[model samples]
Target: MFAGDQNGLQGDPRLKAISEAIRVVPHFPKPGIMFQDITTLLLDHKAFKDAVDIFVDRYRDMDISVVAGVEARGFMFGPSIALAIGAKFVPLRKPRKLPGEVISEAYVLEYGTDCLEMHVGAVQPGERALVIDDLVATGGTLCAAIRLLERVGAQVVECACVVGLREVKGQHRLNGKPLYILVEPRQLTNCSAPSVTIITRRDQLSYYSQDSEN
Candidate 1:
């Protein structure tokens, strides 16, 4: 699972552990779908710590002022990363979810229209920021988050995710900005960006099959 996280250049046991925590279920929330259930990993302490540590270590050099996590799931690890880096945690939420005067950006999801909001002036001008999400399939959520953060004058240093699903076709929205992930679908089955490869097994041979085949 560290295949993508290592930029396809390295591997690690922690990555393998993180991958096993993610479950794959066929036809979830709808038909013809495979959802990466992160709850398995999220529930485990060591797995969650490893996942967060990867990001924390990756962005350690950057002078990150805030770590923004989107919604419910993002909230899980975002705050931990922020705490590790000694930065403030910002929450990106749906419309009206926040009580303050928030700036909002809307984007399309595979299922329906979605929106993300941040309080006005949550980030100061020229502030270095990093956005994290559990996963990125279409890049819609990440793009919307970048827009909302940039709207207030934050420099998006990078974007990261535990998994990326390279089938939805949305990486272009990042505009060449740095994107990091732990794993991608074993096969390039489709032209999807922000692809996420979830691993439910611990066997090294199966998880690294893609690298071996190449």
Candidate 2:
């Protein structure tokens, strides 16, 4: 389950395989909630590496100075990608998680509302930044992430995620910032099903969020 020392993988086939490796838990965190679980994908070494490689390859030479990952889930691949690109890893965490003086931005979620925090000086002015998350449902978290970075004068290059559930509210939420997704399983009403759309851009990823971001 570990793609320990190999990378440089490209194309949809590898991404599709990585998407397939992600497990979906029905009614998780709440009834009628189909929680997309990346822990399963994390177990697959090659899949995890491929995911990180995809982001690393794209940003390695983009002069991206900072890689900011959303709390919890985003922590999984953020550091690795930052390391590959020779950038610093910044964690945007939940309230009070950071011990230093921090700034916060509030956002709504598919389920509720929450805030994201970052250290006061994690990013400097004119620094190119990239935001990473495991999945984007309503995009509230990503939106807040972008705002947090911009407030500090960072140029948010793009927001990347493993999956995106299409939600109309997500549009204009980033104000033209590109949101890239590795995959969006359009159909697979459950984890047991076998259909997913491998997406590389927001236009395609929006196809999955018609009903709800979940």
Candidate 3:
């Protein structure tokens, strides 16, 4: 999707629509956090469809066999992309969320430690996989998803997220997995409202302070 790179994406019209559709809800889930709410984006059928279609068009010919979505928000984009690309959808869920026997991998989040679980036989060795998530704040969740797939012997071709946010300096690299992010938000602070420097993807909304204030 990012054929020419970030600079090229800066000019791409598809991403612009997605970006506009994403609303920055100030102090959501807590104070001082400006959350990028994707639910609104999901509601805009044209924008939502464009977001999914962009991903489908990119991976359609990439020989992707498995689409592993990090639980919750990843579920939103993952299944759509998987169906379009002719890949099976695998959910990497929160602890105890999966009914069957599962394997787990732990990772650190901006707040605390958490883990992701996948069904034992959900994926096969050597199958090409793509991990999708709604946001990549610290990259912990996505990394865990990638490791979980790798542990099961599946080859993860890349990790894809709706947002590519670089808050910490050079902290989001897990085994150098390639990340394909659809939108990198342009931080818009109100200057009048309190601002924080962190954003977490809670599937719903977590807060960070990059906003377009009126």
Candidate 4:
């Protein structure tokens, strides 16, 4: 997602596609659980490029020297974004994920807790950075990442996400340093009806239709 004060930026089509690509699955990994899935968006070239373009346009003029993405899914769009902005990509990995000399920090997740590690010498002092992810819940992971960056003397310029739960207090954890998301969870209610469906390539358009119909 692209960060901005207003939603009517130059990338509305991209935002719409991203909003449509997101699927909500209930009871994932356990009962009483709902998961926000972005795989659909990632798999679609137009949508993925749209997402990348939005971020690129948002930070094109900003002096961002590095783009640090959290582990796993963050790697999907992070490096592309870094390349788009002419910035180096940095990874904040799970414990023991990185090989060589590393730095680590522990953080709480909405479900439990985990730790992140980075190569100690990766980020230089006074570097400018942006953090991106597909989704944010409690903001714990992002905060931990920001702390890690600060510890290494890098200045975090902003935080961006594709989907955000506005009802939650996640943004507060960032200390109001310009949090941005293409779609807020609150907006889900605005759809005629919202449903999650697993669609094959042949049924992709139908899936989007159902999303709007629901």
Report every candidate's CA lDDT. Answer: 0.71, 0.73, 0.76, 0.71
Cα RMSD for candidates in order: 7.5, 6.5, 4.1, 7.4
| Candidate 2: regions farther than 4 A off | 1-11, 110-112, 167-171, 186-214
For each candidate in turn, the TM-score is 0.82, 0.81, 0.87, 0.81
Task: Give, for candidate 2, the lowest lDDT window spanning 10 residues.
Answer: 198-207
Q: Give candidate 1 regions above 4 Å deviation.
A: 5-9, 185-214
- Alpha carbon lDDT of residue 162, candidate 2? 76
lDDT by residue (tens digit), candidate 4, 110-191: 3466788999889999999899877765577788888889899999999888776554546799856677677753224433
TM-score of 2: 0.81
lDDT of 2: 0.73
Pick the TM-score winner.
3
Ranking by lDDT: 3, 2, 1, 4
- Provide the lowest-lDDT 10-residue window in model 4: 199-208
Among all windows of 10 consecutive residues in model 1, the one with the lowest summed lDDT is: 201-210
Which residue pairs collide in model 4, if any? Answer: 193-214, 194-214
